[model samples]
Target: MGTWDIGPFDNDTAADFSYRVDEAPDGERADVLLAAFREVTGTGDEYLDADLAMEAIASAALLAAQCPGGEPVTTSYGPKKPLGVLPGELRPPAVAALDRILAADSELLELWEESGADEWKAGVLRLREVLTGA
Candidate 1:
C-alpha cells in the first residue's frame, strides 16, 4: 500500500547486473534513482524507497543539462494503437505505469518547487531521459 526504502546499495559498475526489469543508466546514483523511479512508476512489481530516490534526483542536478532543447526526452511507452486514448485490455497497466512514474516524479518536483532548489529542479527536468524509456 506504501513505498519501500532500499538503502544505498553498493553499485558495482565493473560488472554488468540489473536488479530490476527497467534499464538503469551508467551512473550509480542514477541506478538508485531508477529503483525508486520503477517503484513510483510501478514499472517494477513493488514499492520504491524515498531517500535513495531523493539522493539520485539530487545528484543528477550536479551534471550538465544533457539536452538543452526539446520539450523533454522520454522513453516510457504508453498505448500506441490508440496512444493517448489508452488501450482495451492493457489500458490499465499502461495508465497505471504512466501514473506511477509521473506521481513519483511529481513528488520530487513539488519538493524542489517548494525549496526553490534550481539545481534540483534542473535535475528533475533531466530525469525525463531516465524515467521515460522514450
Candidate 2:
C-alpha cells in the first residue's frame, strides 16, 4: 500500500475535519491516542508490522499524556443513565460497561470541538462493539 498523509490541523479549515482533536489549536497532535490504540488493535491491512503497531501504541500513549485536557476522549454515558440519547431500546449491558469504563477513568474527559473527541471516542466504542461481537 502507499503512504497516507493524515494532514495537520489548520484553524482556518478545521471545520472540515472528519474527526479527532487536540486540546490546543495545534491540530498536529489530536487523536494520537486513538491512532495508537488502533495500532495496538492492529487496525486495517493485515500486513502492518507488529513492531510498528507497538511503536504506534507507544506514541499514542505519549500524546495522550501531553493532552492539554489530560484526557483521551470523553465518555458519553451519564452517571445514572446510558448514552445514545435516542428514543429507543438501549443496550443496557453495553451502556453499563461503557459507563463503568468512563467512571473509572476521570482523565478520559474531552474538549468540545466540532466533531471533536466525542466522534473519536464513539469510534473507539464501535471498535469494541465489533471486536466483542456485541
Candidate 3:
C-alpha cells in the first residue's frame, strides 16, 4: 500500500491536500486508475458543477499521462469501486472535458503512448466516442 503525493492544485481547499496514487486492488487496476483520476480531479462525487467536472476530467487526463507506467496507482478518500461505468449524467461532461484536455495537452498524449497504457487509453477513447455520439 505504498503512496505517492503528486502535488496540490488550486482546486484543492487545503494547501496540504494533494493528489496521490496507491496500489491497486487485485483485478481492478484499470478501474482503480479511473477512480483515481476522478477523485484527484474533484469529480468523484455527484455534486460537481459542469465547470468542476470539466476540470476533473482534465486533471484526470494529466494524472493518467504523468503516471509512471500509466498504471492505476492513484488513490482518494473512499471505498474502492469500479469506475469503468460512470453515471449517465456524467458521460457528456466527461467526454467534453477529455476532449478539451486532449486538444490542449500534447504532452499527455505522448505520455499515454510512452507509458504503454493502450488498454486504458482505448477505454477512455471509447467512452468519449460513446458520449459524443449519444
Leading candidate by TM-score: 3
lDDT of 2 by residue, 9-103 (tens): 21112212222332323433333334434543433323434233323322332333233332332222101111112111122322333333333
lDDT for each residue of candidate 1 in 56-86, tens digit (9 for 90 to 100): 3322221112223323212222101111211
Worst 10 residues of 1 by lDDT: 78-87
Please list all clashing residue pairs in model 3, or write none if there are none. 21-73, 21-74, 22-73
Residue 132 Cα positional deviation in candidate 2, in Å, after optimal superposition = 1.8
Look at candidate 1 and tell me the lDDT of residue 125: 45
Q: Any idea how many clashes model 3 has? A: 3
TM-score attained by model 2: 0.22
For model 3, the stretches where C-alpha displacement exceeds 4 angstroms are 1-89, 104-106
Residue 37 of candidate 2: its Cα lDDT? Answer: 41
Higher-TM-score candidate of 1 and 2: 1
Superposed by TM-score, candidate 2 places the C-alpha of residue 93 at a distance from the truth, in angstroms, of 15
For model 2, the local distance difference test gives: 0.30
lDDT of 2 at 81: 18
Compared with the true structure, all predictions reach lDDT values of: 0.32, 0.30, 0.39
